[model samples]
Target: MKKSSETAAADRRLSTVARHLITTTTNNEEEENGSFMISSSPTAAAGQSVFSNIVGAPEDPILGVTVAYNKDPSPVKLNLGVGAYRTEEGKPLVLNVVRKAENLLVNDRTRVKEYLPIVGLADFNKLSAKLILGEDSHAIRGNLVTTVQCLSGTGSLRVGAEFLARHYYQHTIYIPNPTWGNHTKIFNLAGLTVKTYRYYDPATRGLNFQGLQEDLGSAPSGAIVLLHACAHNPTGVDPTLEQWEQIRRLIRSKSLLPFFDSAYQGFASGSLDKDAQSVRMFVGDGGECFIAQSYAKNLGLYGERVGALSIVCRAADVASRVESQLKLVIRPMYSNPPIHGASIVATILKDRNLYHEWTLELKAMADRIITMRKQLFDALSARGTPGDWSHILKQIGMFTFTGLNTKQVAFMTKEYHIYMTSDGRISMAGLSSRTVPHLADAMHAAVTTVV
Candidate 1:
C-alpha cells in the first residue's frame, strides 16, 4: 500500500510540472509579439490561410494558351498556340528512330541509373559538339569547343546566359526585337541587361535588315547579340545566305559576340546541314560564339528534355577553364542532367544508320508542315481572306506569323473556337489538312467582322 501511494504521488508531481510548463508557454506566447507559430494551435481559426494577402499572378502568355484551350468545351476548338509537332491526324509524333533508340536502351541490361557528372554525358557532349559544329570543325579538332548537356533549348539558353552574366565582361545581351517570348525573361533574370535589335517588319512580313544592321552596328563592342541560327520563330522569317553573310561580316567587324539559338535547325530546308548554314558560317570565321541546340523537334524527345550548349573558344585552355566555371554554375542549378535522354541521343547520333533514318523522319515532318502551309494558303484564297496570306509559305519551321492583331485573335477564339497567341503567331506543325478549312473560315470571319 505504501509503494502504491508513492507511485500516485509521482504521477501527481508530473502532472503539476506539465501544467506549469503549459502555463509558462502560453504566457510567453501572449507576451512575445514574434512568438513562434504552431500551426495546430487552438487559437488558429479553422481553414484560415496564412497567405491571404498574396495575390494570384496572371498566367504566362505562351503556356497559358494551352490552359485556356483545354478549358474550352467546344468540339471544334483548335490550339495552334503551342510550338509542337502534330501528325496529319493531329497527334503528337514520336520519331521512328527515337522509338528504335528507346527500345535499344530499354533492352540493354547493362544500362544503369548512374548520376552524370556536372558536365553531363561525355558521348552526348562530344556528339552534340560534332552535330552542331560538323565533324571537321577546327574548334573541336583543336579542342577549343566546350560542350555541356543541358535541359533542352531553353535550359541551354538559361545556362549560357547565367555563365555569361557571371564571367563575360558585357552584361548586356541584345536579343532580336521580336524574338522568342522566353528570351528576354531568361537573359534578364540571369542579371544581363536585355536589349533589342530590330528583326521583323510586320509591313513587309519579312526581316527588317536595315534596322537590324543599324541596331547591331550601334551596339557596344563585345556586347552579346542573340541570333536565331535557323527557322526564326513566330514570323518564320530567315535571312537569305547572302544576308547572313553580310550580317556576319557586320557583326565580326563590330566585334559583337554572337549567341545562336538553334531550336528548329532541321525544320527550315528539311536538311540539317543546309539549315545549320547560318551558324556554321559564324563558326567558320574562327571567332568565339555560343550555340544552344535542342533535340525536342528533330529527335522528337520533347519529354526527355535533351539539348546542348556549345561554346567555341579561341584556345583549348580557355575552353577547359570555361567548362570548369560552367560546372560551378550548373552544380547549384540542377546538379546534373538526366542520363536517359542523353543516352537515347547518343544511341541515335553514334550510329550512321539511325542518324540517316532520323534525318528522313525529320524531313517528313517538315514536308507535312509544308503541305499544311499550302493548304491553309489555298483555303484562305478560296475564302478571299482580306490580306496577303502569301507570307504563310515564306515563313519556315513550326510557326508562322499570321499578321493577325490581338482583337482578331480574340475574335477567332470567341466565334470559331480557334486559339493562337495574341501576337498572331500560329504553329504550322499544329495544322493538318482536315483542320485547315476551319482555320481558314475563322480567319475570314475574324478579318471580315472584327473591324
Candidate 2:
C-alpha cells in the first residue's frame, strides 16, 4: 500500500511539470508571433529599422512612358512614346523582305547553326561595310575599315563607346543637346565623361545652327563628337547638305573624332543611297570615323537585334589593330552577335534579286511614314490649331517634335487619352488615316484649352 501511494504522488507531480512546460512554450510562441507582426507592419517595413536602407530607383524615361500607357484603361489611348515604327493600324510590322530572307535561310539545307566568329560573320561584315561605306569606298579598296556585327544600334553604340573609353585618350564624348535619351547614359556607363554641344533651339523649335557651329568649333580637338548621320532622333531635324559639309569641315579642322549613329538609314528618305550620303561623304574624305548602323528601323528587324559597327582608319595596319581591339571589347560584352539576324541580312544582301525587292519594300515603309506626316499636318491645319503645323512635314523619319509643353501633353493624356512623350515628340508611324483627325482634334483641344 505504501509503494502504490508513493508512485501515484510522483505521477501527479510529473504531470504538473509537463503542463507547466507546455504553457511556457505556448507563451513564447505567441511572443514570437507578436514580434514578427510588428516587424512586418507597413510602417515598420518602410522604415530603416525594419528594412534595408537602399532607395528604389526611378523607371527609365522611355520605357516608363510605355508602362504608364499600358496601365491606362482608355480604349482610345495611343502610345507614341517609343521610337518604334508601327503600321497604320497601330500594330508592329515585320517587313515582307525580312520574311523572304528568312525563307531563303530556312531553305539552305547545307547551312549549319554554328558559332560565328568573335567579330561576326565575314560575309555579313563585308556586305554591311560595303552598304554603309559604298561599294567603291577607298577604305574597302585599301582594307582600312574594320567592321564588326553588333546587337543593333544601341549595342553598337555601347560597344563603340567602350572601345573609345579604353583606347581613345580623349575620353570625353560630345553628344548633341536633346540627342537620344540613352546616349548620355551609354557613354557615362562606358567610363567616359559625357558632354553636350548645342543642337536644338527651343525658341525657334529647330536646329540652332550658329550655336552648333560655335560649340563644335570650340570643342577640344581629338574629343569624340557623336553625330546623328541621318534623321536625328526626337526632333527629326537634320542638317542640310551644306550644313553637313560645314560641320564636317569644322570637325576635320578641329581634329575632333566623329562617331555617326545611323539608326534610320533607308527609313529616313526611302532611298538607301540618299540616306547614306552623309556617312559616305565623311568616309570618302579620309576622315577617321566610327559608324553604327541598325537594321531595326530599315529592315523592321527590331526583335532580331541586327546591326554593325565600322571603324575607318588611315592605314590597313591601324585597321587590323583596331579590329583586334574591337574583338576584345566584344568578347566580354556579348561574346558574339546573334546568328539568325546576321544570316537574314547576309542572305538578302548576297542575292541581287532579294536586295532589289528589299529596297522597294523599304521605300514603301518610308513612303507610308511620309504620307502620315502630310496627313497629320493637313489635319492640324484644317482644325486651325493656332500654330504653324508645317514643321510636321518638314521633319523626317518616324517622329515629329510637336512643340507641346508638358502641361499640354498631360492634358492630352488626361482628357483625350492620347499618349506621347512629355517632350512633345509623337511617333508619326503610330498615326493612321482613321486616327489622324482624332489626334488632331485632341491636339487642338489641348493647345487651346491649356492656354
Candidates in order, TM-scores: namely 0.89, 0.88
lDDT, candidate 1, equals 0.86
List clashing residue pairs in candidate 1: none
Taken over the whole model, the C-alpha lDDT of each candidate is 0.86, 0.84
Which candidate number has the best TM-score?
1
lDDT of 2 by residue, 175-253 (tens): 9988877887677656667788999887777899999999998899899999998889889999999999999999999
Candidate 1 residue 154 Cα shift, in angstroms, is 0.8
User: Which ten residues in a row are the worst by lDDT in model 1?
Assistant: 29-38
- Candidate 2, lDDT over the whole model: 0.84
User: Over the stretch 1-451, how does candidate 1's per-residue lDDT look in tens digits?
Assistant: 4444324434543443343334323332221211122223333456876655433444567778999999999999999998899998889998889889999999999988989999899999999998888889899999999999999999999999878866777777898868787887677656667788999998999999999999999999999999999889877999999999999999999889999999987888799888888988999999999999999988888889999999999999999999998998899899999999999999999999999999999999999999999999999999898889999988888898999988999999999998898889999889898999999999999888886
lDDT: worst 10-residue window of model 2: 31-40
